[model samples]
Target: MDSLIKDAVKSGTPIDGADGLLNQLTKAVLERALDSELTHHLGYEAGDPAGRGSGNSRNGTTPKTVTTVNGPVRIDVPRDRNGSFEPAIVPKKTRRLNNINSVVLSLYSRGMTTRDIEAHLGEVYGAAVSRELISNITEVVVDEIKAWQSR
Candidate 1:
């Protein structure tokens, strides 16, 4: 497999069997994996910003390092959007501080009490996320909720 991938890369073949790529299966799998990873990490569909009116409004640049359940991801945040486009993984305004979004959401969905969720988070991530904080995070999704409902 390694040799196949190396050969394909050396030949500059498109991974997805675009032209005449070798190890098409491996390439396809990798492509899908990358897509899934980006979706899981970005929390928004690729190229789907919340608002497309004014573009990303930010100062020179907003640098943030987020530690998701998967691992740490560093991203440059935009200052502002036309109105407010908060990316689910590292909310636009929040600047990025480890993705507790998934953790909080998962715990809540699993029927764990708020206190239990807080303790679990503290034990795993060394930070205690209060129920209030969790609620605040979730509140940001109201727009998404509305969109879903409308749909």
Candidate 2:
């Protein structure tokens, strides 16, 4: 598993898209890293002539702050059964399981070039990832690194 992760990172695989290697990290690793779930009342509405009162939404969200050795990430979690739940880390609207941002960060840490990363993602993940996007994802660490350095 570790070697696979390293190879993916070195190759610059985009974490987006369904069943991609990077996406698998999210489902198999990140989500399970801090497995948590919550349920809340969505609120109630008056009844209609045809039926009883309705609810605004059956799901309630909880912002889960996941702490990792690298840093922390805030993941929004929605609670619902029947496969209606949507979590920000793995959104309901998305078919992918992994976080592209996380994949980029991992790759950047491993010293992969943006162009290399983009190409790797295209070949391995079947996604056309741009070098600019790879840079942007790594750029997010600038402030955090600076703060750590200053400290």
Q: Which ten residues in a row have the lowest lDDT in candidate 1?
A: 26-35
Regions of model 2 farther than 4 Å from truth: 1-92, 95-97, 148-151
Error of 1 at 122 (Å): 0.4
lDDT of 1 by residue, 1-151 (tens): 4555566567676644324432333223222332333333334444666424433433233555544333344444443333343343344445334546557666776887777877887898776455655554444443333332343
Q: 62 in model 2: Cα distance from truth in Å?
A: 13
Q: Considering summed lDDT, which 10 consecutive residues are worst modelled in model 2?
A: 37-46
* Reference-based TM-score, model 2: 0.36
Cand. 1 TM to true fold: 0.36
Candidate 1, pairs of clashing residues: 57-79, 57-80, 58-79, 67-98
Q: Which stretches of candidate 1 lie over 4 Å from their true place?
A: 1-98, 148-151
Models, CA RMSD each = 12.6, 14.3
